[model samples]
Target: MTTTRICVDPVTRIEGHLRIDCDIRDGQVVDAWSSGQMWRGIETILTGRDPRDAWLYTQRICGVCTTVHAIASVRAVEDALALEIPLNAQLIRNLIVAAHGIHDHLVHFYHLSALDWVDVVSALKADPMATERLAQGLSDWPNNNARYFAEVQSRVGKFVASGQLGIFAHGYWGHAAMRLPPEANLMAVAHYLEAMDYQRKSNQITAILGGKTPHIQNLAVGGVANAINPDEQSALNMERLAYLKTLMDELQGFVRRVYLPDVIVIAALYADWLPYGAGVMNYLSVPDFPRDTKGTDFGMPGGYIPAADLTQFHAVKHFGDPYFEQNVKESIKHSWYKGDWTRSPYDGETVPEYTDFQQDAAYSWVKSPSFADEPAQVGPLANVLAGVASGHAGTIGYLNTALERIGAITGSPVPMAALHSSLGRHLARCVRTQVLYDMMVENYQALVANIAAGDTTSFNPPTFPKGEQMGYGFHEAPRGVLSHWVVIENGKIKNYQAVVPSTWNAGPRNQNDARGPYEASLIGNPILEEERPLEVLRTVHSFDPCLACAIHLHDNARQTIVRVNAF
Candidate 1:
């Protein structure tokens, strides 16, 4: 059998380090594996510490999504302590989660994942005038190149002239998947640069509120530590709100004016991609923005989209609520841990053994988190699906529109299967961004009214007076369903285990011989070359992986004695 090796020395524009390996045949990847060689033990480090301090330690797991981790940890601690935050606390927590959603989505689409699909080299030939027309046709916005797209043209020309297409190094330059005209590519390229600056400003909302980006300090179990009075609340009033509002506008603009159109453009070019790279039919999501009283009471605000073989969607319900208790569990059969191999998260246990590369000893510190004893796809797809199933206001309508768009592109109704690829993942993220923007607006209005009625305290620190209890805190983080399980004894952490978004998506095969989401998604992808494996990148980017947060290095030694003797 003839084989072509497809490889990517270093996947660019991702948060952490990983190299893609694929075994290819006939220009398609039939098999693939993602390798990460870095390791640090935050989980082990935090062992035996006070349960109250777990949030502080977890927040440092990753700099990019620290706030999300902190929120999960605090909520988990709160659950364990059986602490009910003040109403104001709920509102603040909601805002922090919302802010993280917006920031993470923007960063994913523009900075971390865009290059995989967008071609920087293509922009060099774009005719600026035509781009302006396309933008005008797409929407009526005041782009710096609104009336004229030439300003971008000049700079892009220089970058290309300099013979340094830094961002396009691994881009499938002439791949069949590229479809946007040079002009449209030009528009996207310019906005790609502009988005970097705009997204940074969007981050300030988190910075001012949380204390910093990547990880914030304002959130706690009881509620936010940062107090917001009338003046502090003013930050979300007109000016700050308007700035946030601008981001929404820009985000929508990019989706419509650039991202969607580019997707269609590429889809048209790679019609064959319509059938390949679909992973397991199982889909699971933990929704956000619950409107109903029942939905609110239980933190489970989303639905679980099962694999194709599974039946209808099921509500994940809140962590504190007893409703979603049926679906969550962790399996250790294939994992390194030797403790109870299979256990319900409600009684989950985490006892880390030292790092050993032996497949059984402990290949990765990440534990396998299964919903219904199976791996489930998380992230944008899960968010959208869960939101719709949870009776989230307007979710169905939004979904219908997305489905229609996918249908039109593929000439077949977009199946749940389509939601597993690079294009599907990117498109799903854009749709979710719109959903999050609206949710933030709704919460912002609610916060204003709550403050008007005379409630100001957003937190209520607890004493853990009883000094022993267990709490399960769950939320849909940027990556997917994130949960914290805590066991408190004498007010200190007796045991802890986290079912993070990445662990669900990135974990290895389970005891029953099942592939994780990433592995399954890589199946059927055509491997192109050993030197540049595009399929591995496809699956990796599809998850918008934040391995840095889930939390992976190298060693070279010198031999001096023999060398000195030879010399």
Candidate 2:
């Protein structure tokens, strides 16, 4: 067998740069490696800076999850100081997070990820009336109808007219995998544009509470810097909620009408995809959505899952909480970290020691993160399963409805174990949306009632009781589990490390040669061509690779060479 290599550096349309290398043997990829080419210095940058400014700086780590990083960073400081933010502060934080989750999902699915499955050019051949039938039959509001469809047609016409198909010039309509008849693609195409506009509105809610986005301000260590009075709380206005409800309504309908069916249509055409990308069964979810306990409001507590029994079918085998350090450890065996060995997150360090990208040697800068010493997977699918298995009411109902919808389309059940691919990623976002929306209502009511309950203030930065201690603050963000650990001495940051979702999913193989979530998922895909490795793209994109947080997509602050066997 002759081997051919395909390398696409700077994976386009994502937030950061990536290098996807595929080893093709007989027209199929026998092995694949994903390299994120940047080094994030957020932690290094915050070392001597005011610990108070940590949240403000850390939020810049990723444009997509800025709100999540800010919240996690501040909560880390608050945990270290043993500070209890006021009820109002918790509610405000909850709102910002939920808004971020909802808006981020809408935008990511429609704008960045949908093109993988939905062919825009093929949509031109779709019968508008059939698309209407799909839209009208759903319980939600109609998707972008005739007028909106016309607008998209004109817009796409302008793009093609401009001779700037750019990346889209090579239409995939003739590909065997392209099976969605025109109208369904048209509906999806229209909503992709509509989702963008609606997502911006939801993001505005975060800005009103936290400041601006791509990164927000005032999401400080001891709760919000901006105070919310009755007027301000009420300023959340029914209009904003209405916008979310409408947009989400359309999204759910489109998922049921356009996306889900599209998945089935494509899957039927490419039945081989069913088994190629299943990675480790280990899964994790950080509890999000604000829940009240003992007069304390906690954003959903973080949690995890392990491969214990297959009969139970995606059941939670193990549970973990805020003390995430016990559950997470990183192995530098195949990464650039020149450490003694795999170290606990609390005791972790990131010093990139570059050797070479040899299979038997160092391949990625991403350290291998394991859960309870296993390669735990994190992402949308994990989020949905954990939410449902944990018995969150909103999540259970959301998942049940999705099962019924997919069942109707497939004429059979989509077993829980299948939550590991293009289908799982999309479904997880819907489940997360439902979960955060429910929390938004619950949290909004709490803030309103707190004021009426005669506690006019929701923030009280208690005088820090002195002690040498450390703590972990963890919660689920839209992408997956997010956590931060901090050790403080003399009211300054002594030791700090963060295990963001991207790191968990994009990490390298461990000493045992166990693959990180994305790498493992990429290993078994069909390559078709050495020059165009679309299958590997499908597998890696299914994980929604976030290179900024992983910081391995070519934006090194400064490169230095250190001699180490691991590097």
Candidate 3:
């Protein structure tokens, strides 16, 4: 049995740099390692800075997850200062989160992960009429006509004819893992382009609510900075709210009729994937989209599921629950850090001790974040499952709807347990998106109604204490549960650490050599072609690994000095 080492360095289409190393034997991955190849010392920079301004700096951690970090940062400061945000601010922030979630989910599926399963080259062979029929059967998407598909096919044909695959390059197009039919591929490709427009619309909604994109400027320590006035044009007024409503409606339609159906179609076609990529069964999710100012009532539920057992699940009722706060610890045992001790995030340190990559030693820049000394998968699947366990009506409804559609497509039952795999991650994202769309409308209406009731306040300026105070902010970000831990001393930041989603999913082995989610998921995956390694990409991409958010940046202007030796 010859064991071969396969390295897919700099996995394309993801936000930042990541490398996957797998030991393949008998055409199956026997062992694997997930490496985040850059160092992001955002926490270090936040030290000694005003806690209020930490959000502005931490938000720059990643271009994709900027809004999430900003929100989390402010919440952390607010938590430390015991600041209570206004009703209007809570609602406004919820809207921004929902909009960002929709945009990020769509981008992940259509732009980043779809090509892993979709055969773009085969799409050129798809019959436009058949593709149109397929599209209509799936959803009432308006662009399902033969002419539209034909146009998409023609564009793809020219792209293929030019021999410049452009974005489609470096993909294993004709591999055995490309299970989707030509018509399915064509439909996915078409929706992929449609998603770009919808993505922009989601961003537009965020801009309206947050006053800008990428790094939103409206968020303050206690709440948001948006001035609510019904008749004023410069404020979050009637006209802006009306325009925002239109964008939400359009995005909701696309999610319901297009994105959800596409995920189901792909899942049904690749049903074999249901058995693989079921990484660590333990999951974590945080409650988000607070419906009330006190945050006692939430639009989405949060909890911890140990070993995928709904029976043993524990729900996190509010922000900074002891169940969450006390259990979360970051281990630098197998990371590029100076210490081997597992410390809580409140006391977490990010002292970098760079060593050359070692297979059995430090291999990644991401510190191993564990819940109760155990590695848990965190993301859409976790959030959805946690919601299901906690009897969240929206989660149950959307999940049932998704499972029913998948069952109908596959002509069999796709159980709730099926959500533990790669296909399930995609389906769970669609389910979560559906739930968020409903909540988006609900929050928007609440915000509008609040302003009409003559309460236009959106912020509560925080007053810091004299001594040191520690607090962490939690957000159910697009990736998963993101927490920013900060210790404030004399109104300035003393210590800062971010236990991001990617760190939970993509970090290296902990003190016990326990694999992270990405490594565990790749253990039994079938490597159809070692060189192409499409199966590996599918599993990794399912996690939506954002190394840019996990590890920091490197100088791309300088040439990498490492030499490659081919065997």
lDDT of each: 0.64, 0.66, 0.89
TM-score of 1: 0.86
Worst 10 residues of 3 by lDDT: 553-562
Best of the candidates, lDDT = 3
Off by over 4 Å in 3: 554-567
Q: What is the per-residue lDDT of model 3 for residues 1-567, given as tens digits with 9 covering 90 to 100?
A: 999999999888898899999999999999999999998888887889999899999889999999999989988887777677798999999999999999999999999999988999999889999999999998888898889999989998888899998777777878987888899999999999999999999999998887789899998888888888888879878998999988987888798999989998899889889998998999999999987766667889988999999999899888767788999998888889897889998888877888978988998999888998999999999999988888889889888987888899889998888988988998998899888898899999998888889999888778887999988889999899999999999988899999999999998898678999999999999998888899999999999989999998434345685668999
TM-score of 2: 0.87
lDDT tens digits, residues 434-501, model 2? 66766776776776667667665555563444555576666677778777767666666666777888
**Candidate with the greatest TM-score versus the true structure:** 3
TM-score: which is higher, 1 or 2? 2
Q: In lDDT terms, how accurate is model 2? A: 0.66
lDDT of 3: 0.89
